[model samples]
Target: MGWSLFRRSRIAPGLPVPGRCGPRRHALATERLLLFTPRTRLDVAAAIAASADAQAQGWLGTKADEVLPDPAVRRALLAWRPAGEDGRRIPRELAEPFTPGPDDPLLLVCVRRSDLGYAGALELQHLAGEMGGWLAPGCRGQGLGAELFRAGLELAHTHLGLATVRAGAETGNTASRRALARAGLVPDQGPRRHTLPDGRVVDAVWHRHDTATPAHCGDHQESPRRRPVTRSGSGHRTS
Candidate 1:
């Protein structure tokens, strides 16, 4: 079965209209993992925890570190994390969910279905038509990076109705380069120097994937419904 990119009004302006035929949350899946729409405090905690990961903090270009320590930030962050984690096994008393609107381009919590554990997250920028993601420490070294990029491609084209999605990886980040390539993104001219949140400057290589471009792309439009997504380690995608 194909993955659904529908949310049930728990998110934003780009969310399927009240009577739209599609799903509200974009539920993408590959062979071993599922990129489900994040909807609870648990997911937020996981995302936050993932961000705090050494790999993430080191490579992520953008960060909310300054605000992350604030109490209001936690509440707001928790307020957006759908109340609890992404499992039904949790006790109701421990569940803490929240709502979404401006938090468009839903972040799909990368989960390993076999164990129902957080692997990473994939983000969609509705208006900008961009995508980014990261994989957890435990899930690295398994070709999951490509899976994440593929999933992001799906959210960009099939689900978000975007004509193209742009991504950039720091120079020397072989894993990310390989992942983008496996997902069909091709080298494109773009900013060579990128600055990270921690004030580190790294040379960045750019890539682009589009619904209408081919020679520029090694792979073409394939449905994310059945496409396998992959990735791992600290990674970032700049538009």
Candidate 2:
């Protein structure tokens, strides 16, 4: 699917329609979504708590009660990677990249551009394979997701040197799937079940996007359908 870029001549126009599709619309100029390094542990916790509360209302997915109090969840949120020896904390350097770390691009927190509030995060553990992301419920509708994701893809390509990245979303998650497709990722298959922190199995769909793929960012035509909600870790996406 593809969309038309809608731009208004500022010199001669009143105001551009907000919904007008644009190609690779940049959300913020600085391109920093708040620091996700280990130093921002408290911020990461707040983000995780907010995401969990948002998930409870079904904006993203269901969160397990077990993870609610665990500090490891915050670590995962901060680094956008799995929790380390501390369980509730992820090393700051690991969130980005360090000399003596795993080759996998660490998970990074996604913050709101305006107030630096924790909006969501992205996780991409495997190269050229599956990656995922999530947002707080309040942050779901404004189109920031697409912008952040585009930036994320660029980061993956630049830092990790990966030519391709993969992702997944539930069939009912219209916003997320649309964000992925708008980011040039393609939907692949049907509902796949995965084990959650609380040992519950939930269904989700798989998607993929390759840097080598000849895709455009303006094509956002996917729609979300209603399905039983599932969880992806405090509603955060892991690579």
Q: Residue 121 of model 2: what lDDT? A: 60
Our model 2 lands, by Cα RMSD against the true structure, at: 12.7
Over 16-130, each residue of candidate 1 has an lDDT whose tens digit, in order, gives 2212222445566666666666556567566655445445556674556532444454343323323333323544532456344543455677666555566777776545555
Q: Any runs in candidate 2 off by more than 4 Å, and if so which?
A: 1-35, 54-66, 69-105, 189-191, 213-239
TM-score of each: 0.68, 0.55
Clashes of each: 27, 13
lDDT of 2 by residue, 1-239 (tens): 01123333421132212223232111211133432322244444544554564343343444455234554664345443223323445456434422213343344555554444456666545333345666665566777667656656654453344555566665566777788777776766534765554455666776655666333223222111112323323222521
> What C-alpha lDDT do the candidate models reach, one value each?
0.57, 0.46
Q: Which candidate has the top score in TM-score?
A: 1
